[model samples]
Target: MIGPTMTPEILARITAARAARDLSDLARQAVGTTAETISPAERIKRARRMRQMVNAYLDTVVVAEALAGADWSEITEALGRREPDTVEGEYADAVAEWSDAAEAEADAAADVEELDAWYARHREDHDPDLEKPVADLLNRH
Candidate 1:
């Protein structure tokens, strides 16, 4: 995938803005939702899930931005890791797994409903212009 090409300052600003929006949304949801009606256990579970989602989203943004401008060694050093090769391999594997999952979902979609649902869930992650290319690549494998 092509990474963002903006300067670091611009990217930082965008990331910060997105994070602020996400925080605002989360706060709004917390206030508007039936949080008070739910059991304590359910509330805890929901909070944990939200935390995981937010952390994963932020980590993805940070890693992508870092990789766009920094060398692998720099990333490894920042991470205080000794095995850059292992980290790189793990990243490649994760990407491959994600792509395989998407391709499998597409291949298994048998009807319009299934395809529509898949597209709806993944619309934000995909570009309409790349559909043909992605399909072609998936078909070859």
Candidate 2:
């Protein structure tokens, strides 16, 4: 079945994530003391770098799982279930921004006019008066 393919860089991402996953120990070394001993500045510096590692770990795991033939719709559903709790307005704004970026990326990557025209023609053949515009390029949660 057609689905998302792993990019060439995915292997590198996997490797980097593997390394990043173990950085807590290295971070301990760099800090050279317990959290209580460190100045607030040092703590924040460690926090920022560790945050990147966590992000990499999450990104690689999700992308690797999806590329390894997992059901993408299921993955999406799982991710949605894991979304952070947020205020109503924050959630709405995030959704809107996600929607806008998705549409923008699709438009950037393809000839929108020709693509929509193709969709129109195909749908017309399949269902005469029921023809409609193509659905969103990237499915958003």
Candidate 3:
């Protein structure tokens, strides 16, 4: 019998498949790294970049997976089991570490904005140029 076609479900499945493939490739690369020309720091930088790439790829993958109506737990479970701790766990921890630093930077930026706005309101208007331009336009008004 011909099966019914579901667009969202099909699309999500495709997205998940692509995400899994990308994650798998990354895991393979991470595992394959050994004592070679590249140092740990370099490897980590490369790994971080790869993780970012995978995360970007997952942005689409996640949306598509949601549209497909797949269970979140199932997806996570599948990824967890397939990826293993060494790959997925390490990558996740590294991303989390970076995310924490980024959040702190964002908080500092917000504080700076608040301070700037406060100072802008309290600061005296000390600009003769502001009047000069107007004075030049209206010489006898």
Candidate 4:
């Protein structure tokens, strides 16, 4: 049968992001939906699940890059060449920028129903039958 095909890098990033988001959602639910919903048992379970998901995602990233023979040394060295203090300051600025952008995104994300619909549409559009078995295997937890 014909299978789904995508660039390795794109697939890796999407898989990583989805897994990260799923872990975040579970952690959020576990810690407490609000100020009052925290249950020790639920929190423990959520923490375990989040850790497992994170490890799995990291493993996926490692394997994906290994398969591609991606060498990160050059990238790392280039990034490391910046003065440590300068890097730290830039990192802090980037964090602030990201936070501001995230806050701005709150308004854009106000339409939860529309967002759900959009997600469904995109998921279907990107559906790859070829990777179904592999995806199913990894998602079995």
Most accurate candidate by TM-score: 1
The best-first sequence of candidates by lDDT reads 1, 4, 3, 2
Candidate 3 regions with alpha-carbon error over 4 angstroms:
1-6, 68-141
The deviation in Å at residue 38 for candidate 4 is: 5.9
Q: List the residue pairs that clash in candidate 3.
A: none
lDDT of 3 by residue, 24-122 (tens): 667767778765578778988988978787776665554444444455555566565454444344344434443334334333333433333433443
Error of 3 at 68 (Å): 4.4
Q: List the residue pairs that clash in candidate 4.
A: none
TM-score of each candidate structure, all chains considered together: 0.41, 0.40, 0.37, 0.40
**What is the lDDT of every predicted structure here?**
0.49, 0.45, 0.46, 0.47
lDDT of 4 by residue, 1-141 (tens): 112333343344345555655675677675665466668886677668778898777655543443344544432344555364553443444334433343333332233233334345445445553323333322432
* Two-way lDDT contest, 1 vs 2, winner: 1
Give per-residue lDDT, candidate 2, residue 102: 33
Native RMSD of candidate 1 (Å): 11.3
Q: Report the lDDT tens digits of candidate 2 across residue range 1-141.
A: 112332322332333333543564557566666637768997779779777877666655555454444555565666674433332232344333433343333332344234345546444344544332222321110
RMSD of candidate 3 to the truth, in angstroms, is 21.9
lDDT of 1 by residue, 1-141 (tens): 213323332333234334544565676687787747888897788778678767666555545544355566766666678887776665664434443343333222233233334434445545464433322322443
Q: What is the Cα-based TM-score of model 1?
A: 0.41
Top lDDT prediction, candidate number: 1
